[model samples]
Target: MRQTLSNPPSGKKTIKQRFLKLLPCCRSDSTSPIIQNSVDDDFELSTVCYRPEGLDKLMQVTKFDKRELQILYRSFKSECPSGAVDEETFKLIYSQFFPQGDSSNYAHFLFEAFDKQKNGAVSFDDFVTSLSIILRGSVTDRLSWAFNLYDLNKDGCITKEEMTSIIKSIYDMMGTYTYPCIRDDAPKEHVESFFQKMDMNKDGVVTMEEFLASCQKDENIMQSMHLFENIL
Candidate 1:
């Protein structure tokens, strides 16, 4: 049976309700009914089609045309029954692909990048914008997005601890694949190597400048930018 957007799973809260729940923590006057109305306004705004100028800009920026964008939006909304996907839902959806290990941390980082609003939930606009960049944006755009994810503290720098944690999450997600199992320290070694190569200032922290300069110079980084695009 085909499910329309109107027919979300029974007993589950609607996406609007979920957004309301998210609003309280984000605002100073969360208890006010006016705040609830503001949330309602924002939710309505997010679901609207892009204006003609905006659509034209999107076509210019991304590979998706109008028809393609419509199709993708439908699929994205259907998968997310609530009309928006929170981090936990995003993590669960991604973890299924790995089938061997915990991908919670990687999904966490990926979701952070996707939540362009930084409001703890991904709107349709957020999903499309981030996806377009990952699939077809320029090298500089992709690298900048990645650095944002690695900069967990949002302090404009990537720390060794943050890099190690993300790398460890990725390795954990990889699990024991093939005949030769990966050692526990493999992620640590990988982090060390990455920092050794990219940390140009020897300050133990990588600024965005260093990340971009190093990534732009690396043949491997340039080659690997589109690796995930094929899967999409």
Candidate 2:
């Protein structure tokens, strides 16, 4: 049976539930107390009401409407009472959704992707902007973001080493959940396959142009994109 976010099996919070905990509008009240109290005491949810400014500007740039933005802001404030999330806290929250695996490396990369300013923190705006792209942006936009995630150095191109690292991190994050039990050399093999199609110029690295063209032209990849729509 397809599990619903509101009723995760075994009372363990699914990735979707952990994700929803960062967006109040869709959150359920049945969250496990163990999970609810997992946040550090120093960063506990505060009773203070935080009103995020620049709703007009955010709406213009992202896909969220005014009401949705407000709801997101509330959720952000609840999790990050200080209006920003540091990398450590971000990793903690992300790790919760993948207890069966070591999500630290993956979380590190994801945190860097969301930390647009490279300021060592993710503000409410930064959070929503990326969330908007992942959950609602156009295919090109989403692909661009995914490319950025893989481009660890922010060097505008993804090398085999970079892709390998990302694939390995993903494997580590999926742990035993990966069907058929991925082989030890799975990450290397995965990178080789990606490079075969993505590095169209035989340049040993995939540029943004190449990545976009390759993915956009692939019917299977386009269809698979929908599987991640609920990941926010």
Candidate 3:
């Protein structure tokens, strides 16, 4: 039987909980500073307070509360003292959770998804924004983000090659941990199955509309989404 979102497997953490726990504890004594500035001239000026860059904006945009943001920020700072994560550090951090698997390729894709700025680095704003959507956004939101990830070339459509690459990378990352042992042709088969459903016009490419419609109608795929949540 397929698992349902309502009934996650026993002892497995929800994506949000798992990510929170995975964050390394903050070891630094320094706190993120709050800036305050005042200027007085002929006219009186009111005091302005500036919280850490993007902190307030993130709170407004994401599901995380102030306390949760504090925890995440502290952890992010601890791991990435320079206030940003490069691809190499990202792969290293991802490898820790799946020690039995080769997480490099999957990590590369994930980092690209999170690097919204396309600057070869992921800032805290980019990190938390993606996390919030995956962990707590509406189904449409999550699916849209997944679509963007699969699009690869930002072409607004998903080709079979792009989907195949994604599936193969996932299988390679899962390695020996997958039960029943994946076959050599498993990635190809998986891609075929998805294309069969998602390529609505038989044009060899899946548009975002086709992708979203098919995914929502497919109960099994929706349930399986939780299984891959740990990849983030």
Candidate 4:
């Protein structure tokens, strides 16, 4: 049987209980009910069809016209069951459902959503929580996402030089086609500094073991590595 993006509802179980266990891979405020509610609310809002009369209104959600709804349904029907939503998929959905220069993209929404207190940037905690909210896949999928960041050389082992390349690839994937868009968020000096962090053993290069150790504590990361090895 194909998997649904979300597990089928176990009748009679409360949403609170469900929410408590949903994102096992994340380190969220398990005690704060408000954070939990905000994440859920944002997710529900995203699923609605959004219409806009102008760029300023692009972010507002609205009712979908019958014809527009049909197109949305047919388009989604074309996808395979294994192709459930992910950050990349969400971006496409937003673009098709609501279009207005970058307003239709997930990046802008994500940046704005996580920029709490009206700060232009997001805290690491906020960013990770939001990502966990969007990515429902288990630990394995999360690991794949991280590995996908570092395995830019695609040779499996990540050396220092390859580490820098991987960071650059991540920025490129985020929709910046420039040579080094990572420099936008991270200074060129800071971007290069990631190699220092990854080179944990200080042997001048990093092996899979070293990289895994740094992120191994994250169950999501390990699950991905396990799945990756099995696939290979």
Each model's lDDT comes to: 0.66, 0.74, 0.72, 0.39
lDDT of 1 by residue, 140-220 (tens): 887887788789989999888998887677666655552245666766776777788788989999899998988789886
Alpha-carbon lDDT of model 2: 0.74
What are the per-residue Cα lDDT tens digits for candidate 3 across 104-195?
98788888999999999999889889888987799999999998888899999999899888878877766665556668987888788888
Best model per TM-score: 2
Q: Score residue 175 of candidate 2 by CA lDDT.
A: 68
Ranking of all predicted structures according to lDDT, beginning with the best and ending with the worst: 2, 3, 1, 4
Clashing pairs in 3: none
Query: Model 2 over residues 153-214: C-alpha lDDT tens digits?
Result: 98999999998887788678766664556688877876887888788989899999998998
Off by over 4 Å in 1: 1-63, 178-180, 221-232
Error of 3 at 174 (Å): 1.1
Pairwise TM-score winner, candidates 3 and 4: 3
Give lDDT tens digits, candidate 4, residues 108-165: 4333444434455443334334344334445444554445444544465666555554
Error of 3 at 133 (Å): 0.3
Assess candidate 3 and give its lDDT: 0.72
Model 3 misplaced stretches (Cα beyond 4 Å)? 1-18, 23-53
**Residue pairs in steric clash, candidate 1?**
none
